[model samples]
Target chain A: MPPRSAPDRLLAVLDAFDHDHPALTLTDISRRAGLPLTTAHRLVGALTAWGALERDPSGVYHVGLRLWEVSALAPRGLALRQAALPFLEDLYEATHENVQLAVRDGAEVVYIEWISGRSAVGVRIRVGARWPLHATGVGLALLAHTDPEFQAAYCTGPLPAFTAHTVTDPALLRRMLAEVRRTGCAVSVRQITDDALSVAAPVRGAGGAVAAAVSVVVPADGIQVPALIPAVRLAARGISRRLGWRPA
Target chain B: MPPRSAPDRLLAVLDAFDHDHPALTLTDISRRAGLPLTTAHRLVGALTAWGALERDPSGVYHVGLRLWEVSALAPRGLALRQAALPFLEDLYEATHENVQLAVRDGAEVVYIEWISGRSAVGVRIRVGARWPLHATGVGLALLAHTDPEFQAAYCTGPLPAFTAHTVTDPALLRRMLAEVRRTGCAVSVRQITDDALSVAAPVRGAGGAVAAAVSVVVPADGIQVPALIPAVRLAARGISRRLGWRPA
Candidate 1:
């Protein structure tokens, strides 16, 4: 492959920021973006002037509001989350659990909205956090509804395990995907953390394709998983309906 | 001014998108960003490849999830919203009104979070939406706490009026700001919409500087504005405490 162009290098500077690194100094940006300090300084100045990055009083760089304003237009981010929030709130009100709305991106699920319930089980998930497609309820719901050809390719991957119950084997993962499709819902039990279980259902867009997923996470011990399935399914369907989807 | 650099031109391609123009074709982007078609195409290609922009099957471009994921780190956007969400939820439950959290950006207030209350007054505001600093409750709360010099300059001119009640006169606006500071809250009545009224309070950061404002909008007619003040102030204080602010 050829070397990255100037725009590509500039974008890499942004990509250097993530859940783990929300704020950084110019030196950190240079090292993480693999650009020279002088180049990074010049680029950071440009971004700050354009309102894409903010330099705080302490001289730490942070993602800025202008970028957030632009990113709010992302259909799978704030737009999708906006359409799904009312339904998620309903689900939260109904179950008083950790309600989440997520969309699949590549081999991972990115949570776009999270509504914590006052009496809900404790879960570590937050907005913009990503988890493996095979280890999350929303991920399974999304992956199950995707094309079978893509699913087959994904199943052959080196699936990482988080706990003893996480399905890592390709064949077992395939069975799990099939089950998710058959049941029209997905239950991820202690896949992410041993104390949590999530029930999720696929949300469809106007074209009848899966656009997102809604889920409810609860404590694993003595949880009534079956009781939560209908609520999650209802929330997902409500959001899908709001998105202009109709059951075929 | 000297000609904008190549980096500025590239950033202008992104600046072309806003709440009104979330989706654009190549021609539209080229015209809006003030770039020739070929230059726009090259920059768009780079942005598309870097996942900052995504092209739809119909050839329209949109801000992409990768950009959204990065922008989610914005301290004044998703991070602050996430921190204040529980308090916002509590406020919503307490009043069943249109609850919002906003931060000032130059002469405008950008709403970072909004919770639509069932059976409450209708509000035009949404998450990531902006309004002038003199035209809304949260805006006034934020402007009231800003530096005196900045506030004087902002109050001087170009205070656009949205409704007849909007405080457009600089002297009156200054007096209103003083009242907001004295009362520790702001009330905007029939400013944005003739039928709506909002009660807002300032939220302080760890350094005891006002960082954001919380508000609740309700129907203006036959409403007890005094009754809503305490609830909005309590929510603001709760969020401020969460941000590590302690009253002297």
Candidate 2:
């Protein structure tokens, strides 16, 4: 492949930072970005000066406040979270469980918001975390409502499994997707983590498209999936309404 | 000055996107970033390919969700807001006012979290918005408790006035800072906008440093400054405690 350009190289340095490797040294960034040491140092200096990255006392580089501020403007990220937060708070107060707000990103789900209940469950999905679509309740809820062609394409993929209960079989996942569309809610039963189960519903934007998903995770054994469905659906509707989606 | 390097130029492209300029065309990006058209096109192509910038239907480029996900990990931004949100919600519920959580950035305060009650005062400060140290409740609360040297230096500067009521005298500002220190909160009366008044308190981190500030904006008239003081202080203390702070 041809050598990357200036912007690609700088962005590659940023790409080197991820969920598992949020903090990195110059050498780490250089190696991960496939750039020479001098080039990495120059790019890092520019980024640090611009406040896209911050250097700690230990010389490890972490994302900075300026980048965070700019990123907050992402419509699907903080804007959606800002719109959904009040409803999410009400849901949390009503049911003290892990309340998560996520949006679909390709074959994965990107968690934009997570409200931790006083009593949280085992599956601690942090904000900005990504999980495969077939393995998460929020993912299935979003994927179910997505374009039929897109959904079919997703179901045709090699679905990875986290546990025995995960919908790794393409045929089974297609059936589950049909059920989700039929019922307007998704129940991911003990797939993400063995001890936890989740109920999720799609949140629609004013444009009537599936903009996001809201889910509540609880302990899997003796799970009240039926009872949780209404609450999850209500939260989804509440968020949808907040986003200007009116059921006429 | 020496010609800016490729990395610096690339960062300038990102810097061109801010609160004022959330969307940009290739031409706009090139002009604002001070790069040649050809250079800008090449860089934008790479950035769009890397998923840092998403091209919209109108051919405008926006900050992408992938970058937002990474930026969410910033400790002083989304992470702090995540920790402080519940208390902020409770405060909003209690007062039916605009509640805010902000952290100091340089000499300014950047609001990281905001919740507006339906009937709250018309003081609309968006998340990621920055305000000067002398003009807002969160700003005053943060500035008041900073190192004494820093406080004096700030107070000595030219205090810009929004109205005749705003504290323009350095001596008066110094006195107000003392009162804020004594009371564990800062009540900025009609500082930013004439009809708005705000009460703010310092939020401490695990090490008990003033890491953030919580504030509520209410109408200037019929203001219960004394009454709101305790509520705001309690909310701030609650968030600080959650962050693992314990008063000595």
Per-model TM against the reference: 0.97, 0.94
Residue A233 C-alpha lDDT in model 1: 91
Local accuracy of candidate 2 as per-residue lDDT tens digits, B156-233: 988888787888899988998888888888888888888989999999999888999999999999547888888999
Task: Looking only at chain A, give the TM-score of model 2 against the true structure.
Answer: 0.96
Quickly count the clashes in candidate 1: 0
**DockQ of each model vs. true complex:** 0.83, 0.69
TM match of model 1 to true structure? 0.97
Candidate 1 C-alpha lDDT tens digits along A42-87: 9999999988999999999999999999999999898998788788
Compare the candidates by DockQ and give the number of the best one: 1
Model 1 chain B poorest ten-residue lDDT run: B1-10
The residue-by-residue lDDT of candidate 2 on A28-68, one tens digit each, is 99999899999999889989998889898899999889889
